[model samples]
Target: MLEIRPSCERCDKDLDPLSDGAMICTYECTWCRDCAEVLGSCPNCGGEMVQRPIPSAARLAQDPPSTVRVFNPDLMAPTSD
Candidate 1:
């Protein structure tokens, strides 16, 4: 199951569950479209942003789970040589 996060890691902007602005990497690190654009790409792995899957209201009604996930952006920072 995709853990749809609630907010962007960089700016902490709210990410709508159905928003096309939500972007993710292979690691499932989530970001908003603006952050992804300004950052030039996924800072963690250079992955491109794509539309996230939104759960239908029917599906959500069956079992509601928190959309928010804990992600530390600092951990994604590149190490200095």
Candidate 2:
């Protein structure tokens, strides 16, 4: 199951499980669209960036969003591959 992670790993921006702004990699590394595009991949693992599924409100409440957040505020997306 996807943790639907709590925030962007690059920007530390909130990415609610149901937020349309959410993007992720195959490993479920979450980020906001802006960060995801800037990174061009998951910085931690280098997986392709893609849109993440948004859970329904009821489902979200049942599963609850993850409290743990992952980010390196000092890290910036690489400019080149």
lDDT of each: 0.73, 0.82
On lDDT, the leading prediction is: 2
Model 1: how far is 49 from its true place, Å?
A: 2.0
Clashing pairs in 1: none
Q: For residue 32, what is the lDDT in candidate 2?
A: 93
Report the C-alpha displacement of residue 46, candidate 1, in angstroms.
2.7
Lowest lDDT sum, 10 consecutive residues, model 2, at: 72-81
Model 2 per-residue lDDT at 36: 76
Which pairs clash in the backbone of model 2?
Answer: none
Best by TM-score: 2
The C-alpha stretches of model 1 lying farther than 4 A from their native spots are 63-81
